[model samples]
Target: TNDPLVVFTPSGKRGRFAVGTPILTAARQLGVDLDSVCGGRGICSKCQITPSYGEFSKHGVTVQGGALSEWNSVEQRYQDKRGLKEGRRLGCQAAVQGDVVIDVPPESQVHKQVVRKRAEARDIVLDPSTRLYYVEVAEPDMHDPSGDLERLRDALKDQWEIENVTADLHILQTMQPILRKGAWKVTVAVHLGDGENRPRIMNIWPGYYEGTVYGLAVDLGSTTIAAHLCDLQTGEVLASSGVMNPQIRFGEDLMSRVSYSMMNAKGADEMTRAVREGMCGLFTQIAVEAGIDKELIVDAVFVCNPVMHHLLLGIDPFELGQAPFALATNNALRLRADDLALNIHPSARIYMLPCIAGHVGADAAAVALSEAPDKSDDLVLVVDVGTNAEILLGNRDKVLACSSPTGPAFEGAQISSGQRAAPGAIERVEIDPVSKAPRFKVIGSDLWSDEEGFDEVIATSGVTGICGSGIIEMVAEMRMHGIVDAPGLIGSPEQTGSDRCFLDGRTYSYRVYDGAAAGGPLITITNRDIREIQMAKAALYSGARLLMDKFGVDKVDRVVLAGAFGAHISTKHAMVLGMIPDAPLDRVTSAGNAAGTGARIALLNTAARGEIEATVRAIHKIETAIEPRFQEHFVNASAIPNAVEPFPILNS
Candidate 1:
């Protein structure tokens, strides 16, 4: 006679088990992701499952009665003390009596789905690299002559089915004391190795370790360094922080930094030290914010552009500065935290995503991973706007990537009366088409300049200056109101029919706010400021157009802006300036900090590392410097809203 048939729901995994077999045992045999913290002793209550009765057609299983054994003493005691939900049974204690169907709830699954910011985006499942396992080792015996470490390894294999486990020298030295302290029972944090690594023990606790380990996902950008501290078990973000890159003292951009390294003898080493010091400071700040011991951070992942990648790894970036732009290496890296002088766990492992090209580095690969353009059916264009822009255009069939040198103007560096996106910076703007009068909103206060109670709100963080987003809107509004001409020239006050426009030297300036009497700088938009914005936006549009030419497509179905500045910039203004190709306004949306999200994804799911590595290989890289049409596109894009391209959607 055949034994009872067991079928698990949601995964559709089926198996045949003996009459006395436990549900938890069957789940483990079938490789289901049911969680258990207390080694199935009914203490943690993490393996609760609900069984369904009277299933007729699916899996050919039917249950009339007595499909599961009645609740035992341990379960009864647990229910009496803690109270289990109705229709719930502990997988550990419930024995199969007949053919049965089990439904594992989302809460019981070890890898639960974490929803992304956008509803349409794919959800990330929690499958962390490191995990905790509890084991009971045999006591040392003089007759057996087996070492304590050998017994522990044997226990792990016998109880948890883990084999070929290794440990560092430090773990070896401390193993004896910890084994005796826990009385032969200990909980070990193991890094479940990937293709290139073997399973190794990261840390050990005396007995039944209750605390969870942590991982750091860092997005190392040229302008700033950002980090997120996350819990490995639950996939929760504990704290988020950022600090300036600090290498800015050497140079403002990548090429400038490379030049500084060439001009100065010790410039490369000085920059390497500065960036590492800044990173350590950021790690400490975040660890303090999360109120956790730094030693608990067991894993970390970093994503960055090529120059920053080279600098972080202590490689000189001279190769990336010259023609052909060859990188030192383009493969993913795995190392220990101590190797990089990071003060996390002494043996904490770090993974860096692969770089796509010499200029299109791992940051672009991170954006592709987060957006998953290769998986999309519709043609999509993803633009990560920053000091240097990374553009990707692709679909399910193929994908293309390129990098453009847009400069630091977009970050409010070169523009006059500009500042970073801090409190009191003007972030929103509007201008009346006929009168050319302007009203705007700063970052701290939500009220418009003309609204009541606006003065009170401004008393604290007075209007300081305009930011990147503010500059985009300021230029776009000027074009829309006929204040700035198509050639990026501000008309005279009489010609523009507005007293706000006045001749400053030979050219004209548009005054948005005149508060000099109130001890505030006279905030105005100069002709040179218009020229800087024109150059920045033109470079951005030129790169996108170059990718379009290679793809043999006239227009993309959708556009996704993926950066901090992209998240806040006005889509209407971007279209007016022709910063991006013309498309339906509704189809253009923002994926806030896509590169950072990708880093978090890789941190939480180890399998994503291989997936992005494969995707990077398949992607085709286009060099914008070599493309002849790039210069042509730049010239046309220099004019406000393009000199040749037509925006039918915006005109309508």
Candidate 2:
């Protein structure tokens, strides 16, 4: 008989398996990480998979109910003991019998999981571009013989002192109904304009909107899209939510997406629709959570890197792929939400912060505004670590910015078993120097695998692959434990005098966790994994060094890690890994989602938009790709804490 064809949804990875082939084995062959703490013995019960037995048109796979084998004694025993949820089966015990489609939920996969979304606490003065006006328009008199729109405009000008306000064609079509329904007393949503432009009426509602008017401040990250629903009146963030970028299905990183666009004719358009749809979903979610109509969000501010910015605006990012990477436009954009296909008020204005350069984009400008590196007397270095690390350094007198290609290693890409920071992922690790015994903690659980009562805690989610932060700490801990050397070579048993270190073909591997006996897969750190981390960190550190050299400063007084990944990373581990320059531990801190906060500030204060625009223009951009010294810096930075540059603060 022909082998069974198994397909995994969302990722669209598929493989053919022989009769009785375990689902876990299929996932492994397809490079999908499913949590399995007990190898394939089914004791750990971590390799749980949900098989969807129906036509999955999106994935082009139809799974029959009898495609997989029945529950074996091992799975049944574990289920009786631990109480497995209905419709969930152990991937290790449930073998493939025919064509099947498996849905690896967030809890099952290491790379995909619930993203963290928390608004950064900051203060901003309210000066929103959107304002609501409740006006009582004069009844149209046959004697006066004035048009309804003209009468409405006269009322807005007379009552609210809003001058020269105009309505769009769509607004005009629905204007009469709203005015008549409100009995000539309606509320109008006005989008305030700058000194150069005239204010325009966005939305018209029957009667007064008793609820608060809202605006969305969005940080369109390559990996995650976070949004904050702010009260336009008070500038307070009423609700916050985030979702993984739907474009992740197309490509995991920005450059990959750009490449996809280059390869496919409609790639850019497809990605644009995916993200806009995701934003619309988020808008609906925030509105429901805040108990307001989605139309109440009359204004929005968006900040993203150059690629995401282009994709969101439906601009083809093909030019961004080559040297002298050109941006479609570096200027701050003011467009209609409808033009971008965002499901907000039809006439709502969308403000995008200015892009700093070809690589450094509006997100960088937002970060600069949030941190205000130029406002400080002391030299300040602000680093946003993502697939591309954006570096800003300087004081009030001079500010320098640069973009470094760190790849996606820092975000859990490029590693053999790497994943995004998510529940069930191994987030923290420790190894005993003597025995080389490893103990670690997953994201959802508080207890380490070796700690007491960990068995009950681990039952929630089994040990998955290492995430970004976990990968960093694991490599740093390996270096500290003498499992790996300065040049990033894993030590052999003969070299380290420990059995935990062993040879894997031509290279050596360090055993991080031995779970075979417990039915979990053996987790090991290969020499290649170390090199990937080194390359990523080296690029980041080299970029910072280039800026420091240009700024004529050997050391910065303060360092701000500005991003979600930065927020969770350990400063000590970062220093040990040479991901950043040396600084006093306390002096280095994360500026949790500073770009998102900056978007919020711009959403609330129109002046802030101008302030960031001016700041970005004043910032001198250093192109690391063109810099000759970047190679030298990267070579030195490849070693832990740098091979040449003395990290006196970190050494102490």
Candidate 3:
């Protein structure tokens, strides 16, 4: 009988195995590293794999049911005792029954992903909505016959000076027991509502609960979701964690995800569940890191593009796929954590930043709030570069914002040998002008590939592939070294006078790095890769140019790159590649996940919610699709440093 095929992702290893062969056996045969400390006995449970069931058109695989065998006795017993994660199976016990795509989570693999997201350090004043009030109520007197609840209400009013405080319906059921336990002296956790709304008691704890109140701030990016656990009282970030947006398997970019929702009957619901589950995982992680109970997270603030904003709320994004891009709602939202199925306090509140437009969603609003481009005296340009680049330009007088479809090239989706920012992924690159040779640094190691003792490091974790930042630097360096011309064409060996330049078949290519081991693939930059970068950069520059034209400014005084990818990219390369308008290099800096930071601000300070809400309303929204000059600007910006616009600063 023919054997079943099993493919492992992040390593891209594939193998064929007979029936009853364990997944760990297949992985080992293919040289894929999966942790198995107990020698396939299923005791450690470290070798767990998630079998992706469905059609993955991009990878040309269709995963069917029974691809992996039913849970064995060992796996079942382990799960019963130490709960296995959803969709995960013990790789040693689960046998291959048919073709399948297995995802070895970063934690389960011997090699792990190097998470790069960090909480941007900023001081914020504490004005959290959740407040602790210590109250002393008169014990229920049989002589007076005043009810326990009524007397407690009166005491709350007299002691805390809070009026119209109502308890949640669940709180009422256990009120008597909690009152008796506290001996009428209890600390009530009150959650203040929006303007004109009554304050409500969220939790009533016996005695003074001296622990710190916690809140979560989340930036739900199209590619990644990051979370920060903060002390609601001190406005201090206690822990930060991030996970790859699980929706990537469904589709790579925003429009693709929207398209997936359009094509698949239950696509929207599936994506929603995936992200919520991912968020739940992050919540558990941050809570453990902070040494706090999961229920203590009483509040959360989120920011994401409109698509993510809609999907997270279970809204269909079908209309967003068409013209006019209708949004179900653009106003800031407040919903119960349980409504969204988030793992937090039962009565916790979730606040979402307002969406600026159909394309420019709450993430852009969060960027505007964190950067405050509208408050600047000089012309300020803020670009939150990602799959979709959101541009904000203006000063105190006027602000203009637009969204450009830059695609996933910048995030390493379209490029050959491209991968997400993992441990072995190349993140930094430098090209020597003299020899036209390149050296690079991977995420986990500090030393460059050309430096001493680099071979040992590369031996441990092989050079994986180029990431977003490395792509930017590679193209910019190619252009600077005259290996690429003004028309975005890679030069031949005769023209560049470098052996590194050669023609692969019809088009020219440059060797970036030789393989670390024999027969390993050489990292090469093809002409097609450069074109992908050009198209991505052109879209970004054109969007910024359109915003600048709306602002009636020739050049921006400063440029702020906002996002994780933006923070990692070199400012000089961004300018050289015409990804942003010309500005002094010193004035160009990263805002460092501005959306996440803005979410944190809103979580700690309620006033910020109102401030950004007003700011988004006052700002003008320009639709790039409707603009006529967008195409012309895009064509001109496709060239390095732009063909039409003069970058005198960079030229000097």
Candidate 4:
């Protein structure tokens, strides 16, 4: 039994194989992750592997030059056409000649891990719903009297061990021609199925499909619809894009949109059509950025607010706008692309995360999935700030959730000279405590307003307006430098000792920038703008405090500011404005778009879909609207950093 010893690196899986055995066969026998779509036929080059040869004292073996057989004709042919990397060999063609160590590159492994950018976040493991399989089928014969599809199924069952597979009518229509075209051998993209679904064919190719499929992880916000087009097999984000929600013309906030539906007969339908069109456009842009065909996208996962969820599904949101705030359904949905008129693969699967409640929607559930407060030992609070803020407070034993209607003030709506986060929008600000002068940075430029070449930096997108994050820091800096009072009012020049503060309409306004000479609009923070921010932050704080009350806690170990806006807001500025609860500044972290991350998690791992569903079921929902304590907290939170609740960390 003088067999060659084969060892696979990164996994440390070792086994003894016959000398002439194919590396792929040896890898399969030892449970190594070597991929192959065309079996051992070498038609697909997915089974590429690199072998090492040297003295190996640690592994207790001495490698030689003839460890693996020389590349065969199939490898040479593949290298000539597609060009394999130097020193790489096709595992399906290379035979084990002696003791050898093989390394499987990340791209070659089917379940490779996709590293996340966040230090504390979990990596996404590739385990998509749809996968490709190459199989050979017997051609149909009149004498045998067997259908082509039956023979294909038999081939799948015999070759791949897949059972009871079904195909859509579209596949059936083209199956005859494709089967004959491939000379009875074809590759089929199969949706492995979930819940009550049966394994079915999504698409078919003549032979082995050289290209991989794609999936979409979408975060459908009330203001914007964002999507991440990802490689299904690799879990890599090929492109990310977003578009402003077209429903903004109808209403800026969720409640207004709901009211519009109630007021107009066809308002709901019109809004639905607008949103759908917007989503389709976003998909097209994302696909183009990734340089892939839209039809290659076969799976999608969506996380959205309750109202958006209902509207997207063509359901009237009247119940969501009233008392009790009942949702039509809160279950996770699995559907087809055509059911929603999506322009992706016709048979693509769409999975929506489960909703937490009428107010706290699937977006909150997605946040929970990504942040996972329920699994934490330390009591953590997660706040997803937007038009409406979704707040969660919990630990290992219990968790409570609530929603606060923060409105569109945070997104720069309903404010004089305010705009969304865009180029030329002021995003960072700092004021001198003595001079009472301000220096700020706009979204598109890295230079500060007082720095050299600042004008040229903003020349293209010329100082437009203040955005949500900018307004937060501006007001916070105003309060810090005594330009604005704790009562949320801008002071007069005499009272504040700042000449930039000028009286306007019986109140005062702080002039951040005066661009009149340059033919640009004069940008100022009016008394009303502070009031809008106060209302938005108060609602956000009250929601968090309401959950704290329900959880019977006055403090939390950590605070995760989640959302695109949250990622940019300074934690110190946020605390000065009383946007969140008291916590160490270091403990207060930003989880950029946690709901979108959760959607990506669900898209890559099918098991995560079930995990989030179970988590959503266990979460306790608190209705902030009905709770009297919410009013009390709202009043207290209206002041800068709370009137009653002391932020000891911020104070220190």
Which of the numbered candidates is closest to the native, going by highest TM-score? 1
lDDT of 2 by residue, 393-424 (tens): 98899899999999889877788777778787
Model 4 clash pairs?
A: none
Backbone clashes in candidate 2 total 5
Off by over 4 Å in 3: 1-123, 142-147, 516-519
Sorted by lDDT (best first), the order is 1, 4, 3, 2
| Clash number by candidate, in order | 0, 5, 0, 0
Q: Give a tens-digit lDDT track for model 1, residues 1-652.
A: 4888888887888888999788999999998878886677776688899987765445555545438888999889889989899999999889888888888998888897755666224578888999888888899888889988788889878888788888888899888889889888888989988777888888888877879999999999998999999999888899999999999999888889999889988889999888999999999999999999998999999999999999998899999999899999999899888888888988899999999999899999999999999999999999999888999999999999999988888788888889999988888999988889889999988899889987775677888899999999999999999999999999988889999999999999999987675567789999999999999999999999999999998799999999998899999999999999999999999999999999999999898999999999999999999999999999999999999988898899
Give RMSD (Å) of candidate 2 vs. truth. 24.3
- For model 1, the stretches where C-alpha displacement exceeds 4 angstroms are 1-5, 53-66, 73-87, 118-120
Query: Tell me, what's the RMSD of every candidate?
Result: 2.1, 24.3, 22.8, 2.6
lDDT of 3: 0.84
- Which residue window of length 10 is worst by lDDT in model 4? 57-66
TM agreement with the true structure for every prediction? 0.95, 0.79, 0.80, 0.93
**Residue-by-residue lDDT tens digits, candidate 4, 1-652:** 7788888877888888999899999989988988878887888888999888775632565555548887789888888888989889999999999888898988788777887868335667777888888999897787899988899889888877789899899999989999888888899988889978888888888977778899999999988899999888778889999999999999878899999999999999999999999999999999888899999899999999999999999999999999989999999999988999999999899999999999999999989988889889999999999888999999989889998989888888888988989899999999988999989999888999999998796668789899998999999999998898888889899989999999899899999998887778899999999999999999999999888888888888999999988898999999999999888999999999899999999999998899889888999999988899999999999988778888888989
TM-score ranking, high to low? 1, 4, 3, 2
Model 3 Cα RMSD, 1 decimal: 22.8
Return whichever of 3 and 4 wins on TM-score. 4
**lDDT tens per residue, model 3, 147-253:** 66677678778865677887777788877888889887777777877755567777777765556578999999877899999877556678999998999888878
What is the C-alpha local distance difference test score of candidate 2?
0.84
In model 2, where do residues sit more than 4 Å from their true spots?
1-122, 180-183, 206-208
- Weakest ten-residue segment in model 2 by summed lDDT: 112-121
